[model samples]
Target: MQSAQCSGRTLRFGFFEVDLRASELRKHGIRIKVQEQPFHILTLLLERSGDIVTREELRQKLWPAHTFVDFDRSLNKAMTKLRAALADSPESPRYIETLHRRGYRFLAPITPIREDPAESHANFNHAALERAAASLENDQSQDHPKTGFLLSHPRPPATWTWFSLLLGTSTVLVCLTALFLLRVNHSIALGSSFGNLNPRRSVAVLGFRNLSGDSQEAWLSTALSDWLTTELSAGEQLRTIPSESVARMKIELSLPNVDSLGAASLSRIRKNLGTDLVVVGSYAILGEQSHGQIRLDLQLQDTQSGETVDAISETGTESRLFDLVSRAGEHLRDKLGIRAVTREEAAALAVALPSNTEAARLYSEGLAKLRVFDALAAHDLLLKSVAKESNYALSHAALATAWGQLGYDENAKAEAKKAFDLSANLSRAERLLVEGRYRETAREWGKAIEIYRALSEFFPD
Candidate 1:
């Protein structure tokens, strides 16, 4: 039957209709296959609608009071299945809002179709219309002050005014709806050419190739990658895989050491790291270390297509290496088609980056050493990095890792706390990492796990 034929018993929300008497759920007049248990749970949530449906209530309704089962697990599994069928996400729920351990509430606004065709036809904003009509009648009585005159006169000016007001309101609503649809269509046309799009794009910055031919400055390879990754993480639409995670994965996969990655390598990185884009780059530092020129080249590779989607390049003085990194990061972000940060955010980001090239170089090398399990070298390098720029938040965070690796619990906790304190200007991902590290040091496993889970949701690599 057509959705229009659904009686007053039928509940409608969005494109879905629930016919309780028929024990059926239909979306756009097509029946959806929902299991018995999940359907019952859905029904309960729907009946309660705006109110919370507690777990205890659900359990009592689903099973007898005397019955025994793994209630929590069963409820969770049912919810998962129901959400899968609805194509809903627990994190950003559309229809069902989870109340953690308490209960669930249906989020969508529901309308019950009237049994009479005339009433059903007028159901659109019926409540508003009723209120308007009642208010109009009261005003008409107050103005005329003659019930007998109103009864005799079958027509009142207030009646015409109410109709005019309703008509104007409906016209405005129609125009707004049309404009909204036009904007939606325009957005869809401009969204993508390939038609394969994700709400958030995940990217990984592989260790840059050091073409400087300077063994002492080899740290630039990992340093540049980490710096770029951190910079990209500042974007709301981009999820960046941590440089340490990418390095560890590279070692685990036994990937070849090369300047550029092949298709197979890109595919493997995508599969293991869950990254949509891989940034591969090379840098060169010419002339002398103090008065040298640095040229950085970067490529944004689409993992699925194994193609270099875009290339970025920047040149600057070697002494202002961190400035070059920042410029390169901005270039790469533009190439990715991500929105630029606001003025305030840009200022905060500037503060988050290392103030001096020396501190950045030391921190990068320290982070690289720490990833390789050389806690002693990492500790020395990171200590000197902080000594050079004590307010560098990332340096303090890396130092905490070094201390933790060396089994200095007190020192690790102190460093983690310091990092957290300094993370106000850091990127969202960096701030979360600092908070998680601090929680771990404080032995707050639950809070640490929650923070890590949130980070995983944001980055997912």
Candidate 2:
């Protein structure tokens, strides 16, 4: 239990306070209602927030030890009423959350106030005696002070009584005052943290521009963009937009000169895609050899701040495209503190298809064309890629997405299922894509669109 003061009240977390002298529940400064028998049950639970307060224990506290009551029903009713009054639910609760077969736990943190330690001690000593007097008063023994003292202690003189009462009242007030100050401090801290949060701490990867003069290199660009999107989305913490949506947005707001799409364009892209950061990159092949060197120029810019946060270029052999993507992803992870899927784990989960194989290469090229909104061309190339290598899962998945986009639901569903079966670690977004195609086949356009939006977040470039 923590102690603090807020608004001149002593608000207590555990153990309900019953200031019988003032007829209030003053844990700190705020007054909690304690109407009737509910107060007895509340007090017991408060004293032991995380511990079980058995029905028998509550009955003993509320009624006499010898008294017999229908413990189960009455106790349950009281707890339900208490929870209702406190605005707490057994399911998805905040304050008095339930613990199933066990008992309840007071989840709220408690703060108590300590004002004038010396005075508090002195008042405590006197308050005990005053309470005794009050108990006697309730028992119709107020007049016979000496008679009450035979069982306990006698009341003092009138002047002494008034002085003790005043001291007790002052102590309660002090507790309340301390509680108020503490609450205000806590509120301020929460408000400050919330206010200072930067919404521009998010980024999206746009589909990479294919600068390979040869049409065969197109797959490499799509493969790089798709892999990067997957790596970024794996971070989970970073708010990455989906590649599919970015691809659509890129075509919708086609800026001819890629370099001309600066801060203003980035802002428009972010607004259109509902993202904070935008990433744009281009890839190029520099030789005619099968294992040519590929260069990637990548940039990350904050939409709201209109400033670049990261800009770097990586060059690697085209044969090691996946490896380059992995390295690039690691770089971004280090720069932006983005979490990444481990190489060993990612490799183990990856669909085991020959990357450098002709079929895989063709599929990768088709995917690239699809990224740039050339769906028909992409479809044709992807079909060729699959024909050469029917076992390539990625090509099959890409083909499925293309088919779905072009309204070939039956074919898309079959391909997506094959992808799901072949790929060990299909992302949530990818799974949604498969489901979306399945839903589309059933003519559920609304649900299919919803799934597509979700898939876009993971694939958004």
Candidate 3:
């Protein structure tokens, strides 16, 4: 029904005027074959014409109800398709502009036109069917003898045949209704499950309390916390809180050290962390060998109900910290019936990044400093981290964070964009911070921190 007039013969934009309804791309009057999802993405860009579309917004629009899709892969593929179709290189994009950490924006103009005659006829038929029942209502109100006779009855049918027909029709309708209801119920159940699924799993890993009487392993608690944060972060499913925040909370609560905390302090720590899951345990160094044991106590408590859905503990040795943490992660996944990333997949992700043990250690140190609001120190450490491993996505993300904290918006954005371009696994919070959206940035950071905390408990050294 909607139409517009075009004064010119051609609707041109760098040799392309995509047909939105048909989901077709035409370059200089030559058709370009674009896949379904990419075509939808192009259509979305065309509709937005002159505004920035955030990646989050695009994800929600394109994959509104599906969570299984690899959004990063699909989105990048679509963008590649678009660039190829438009002959626009990423280095010097003309039609579509990539806004780095933000979303995409259409750099061209789009003009609407009236539907052609054949298209108009097709639309009319579709509209006519949609209005058919309303038209019949008006027709029924009119004085028409044929309509009245037809409505009255069908006569002279065989009684047995009529009965059989009626029975068969009723049975079919009942079956259809039952099937529809069953599907509706299934959808409702799945909807409930989806509602319970939080992409950001929050947990607080309390620093290990040093129970050993000797002061020789004084730094053990801090080292354990840092190690756990790093090892646990290896799994993308968890959002571990930075150790600095936990340390700050401990100081604020006037708790001398993690080991000095009692049951009350543990509860207070959980509240301060504001996490769904709380991890509490103690560690002791045995003899000169520095042998230590850790027990990971996990509790998923409801904020409203104050009840725990999951509560379990796992014991492990310092030598097998990674294995212990992986086991705890499995337990948590089992408790929630959540899907997990396989070890091979996790290793692949780790290898794909530009980070080694030293770079990771520096990055972790920088993150801890950043958590305590030490922007200068964090920046210095993060710079060293990236210098050590230039392609490290997490380090780039951390550098972006430090830059943003120091008011270097452009530099921060550029670094963040590079990080995401290299690997989408950079903590979500780091990505948001680079985008200049503080609230969302904090939210994502919190989520990442919580996941780290949970992992730390399971993998304590």
Candidate 4:
């Protein structure tokens, strides 16, 4: 906890000063355009400067009991908005620094004005709040085109890294495929307003219950959650607890599935993980006579209230698992009103599915293993992927990262070069990732960081 006794309920960091009572975030005496969620997030961060504020702490304090929200996504979006207001970067965060899968910390020196809570609110400066609200509304009303959601799709979104039907085009085509891989956090059913889920609630996707009674299918629990989290990774639509974080928790509890979670368990989850949305579901084999058919019962609930904000059920066979999951992912994306580049549009842009699903699967698993620090496994998988499909640029690029992790500088550089050579047809988003890798492998730290900064800004997936 930060002391407010030094200043009078006003906190200053860098060029920005946040009057806690006024709920106004201003730079150089002018208010910045920030919504309530972003402003509140900044205020909370300022209240705990220098110390790390866990994602759970933010949810506990700011989100009310019964506040249905997407805490992680909201926090990320708010942080992004705050950074934009402060002219900061994640590559080199100036004020708020992410602690990877842990949480965030305020990096700048903060000047706090301590004052009586009653006194501060007595002089709340409603005028400033009004000004901020007005600025936000004005910005929203302006002609700035946001890629809003489309409601017509039927397929659930699959994890971009995993299930998008890959196309074996040129290296450029491979890069383009990577661009279409929008990360998903979690899925929620859409209502009339498309604003039902608490936009700023931090969330966790617990393992879906495997009622199939077959231990072989146990991997579905974590894998499905991981996929949903990846699907929701576009921009800042939802804050998803990383699989590694969730895995750590699972290791501690040894709880089999989310269906077995009790109120006490739920409370522990909320406290330990700091989640706002509890995505818990169950899956069962469709019929004893059926070989591969299964059904998923999924729902997004308000952690504090234990209320189901949204829910959906989908059925498919093992052969169509990818399609089923992708449909669910797409439904969640649509509910959130985020626009995705359609398959037709992508095809029109000359993007085709990779020729080998197995290669694509290897690439996906390699990336996953790499995320969990199992670089050796990732390296092996990446190698196999490229060997299976020699034209798989993503596999090569990922292999470069795995090699770098294992201290194989020469191998890393060679793989990176191969990726770059194959990237002539990459979209802006794809080019940003490959170019940054190219620069980094060449030891151009300045260029790599600069490109990464731009990539973070332009393509935040």
What ranges in model 1 sit over 4 Å off?
A: 1-199, 453-461
Please list the residue runs of candidate 4 whose C-alpha ends up more than 4 Å from where it truly belongs after superposition. Answer: 1-223, 234-278, 282-291, 304-306, 334-355, 364-368, 418-438, 459-461
Question: On a 0 to 100 scale, what is the lDDT of residue 265 in model 4?
Answer: 72
Better by TM-score, candidate 2 or 1: 1
Q: What lDDT does model 3 reach?
A: 0.61
Clashes (N, CA, C under 3 Å) per candidate: 0, 36, 13, 48
Candidate 2's TM-score reads: 0.48
Best by TM-score: 1
| lDDT score, candidate 2, position 312 | 72
Ranking of candidates on TM-score, top first: 1, 2, 4, 3
In Å, residue 235's CA in model 1 sits off its true spot by 2.5
lDDT of 2 by residue, 1-461 (tens): 22113322444454444443354663334565556676656555655655666655677677786677776445555665565345344434555655433455667655544444578888998999999877768665654556654354576899999999999999999999999999999879866746444343556677567776566565665567667777666635566666667766764565432422577887788788888777677888877663678888887777777888788788887666667777787788788865667665476425443455576677766765566534556678888887887766667778886665444567877877676565545555556665665566556799888888776544443
Predicted candidate 1 versus true structure: per-residue lDDT over 1-461, tens digit per residue? 23333345778888788877877887877887888898899888877777889988999999887788888657766776676556554445688887756888889887886565567667756988999989878877876667523334455599898999999999999999999999999778756532544558888888777786778878788767876776776756687787777876775565533456779889999998989998887888866753678788888898998998888888887566657777877877788787776677667668777878788888878877766555667788999999999998888888997776554678989999999999987877778989998999899999999999997666543
Candidate with better TM-score, 3 vs 4? 4
Over 200-291, each residue of candidate 3 has an lDDT whose tens digit, in order, gives 66665666665765554444454445554544554555666766567667545555543233455556766787655545455655454535
Error of 1 at 456 (Å): 5.4
Best by lDDT: 1
Give the TM-scores of the predictions, in the order they appear: 0.54, 0.48, 0.39, 0.45
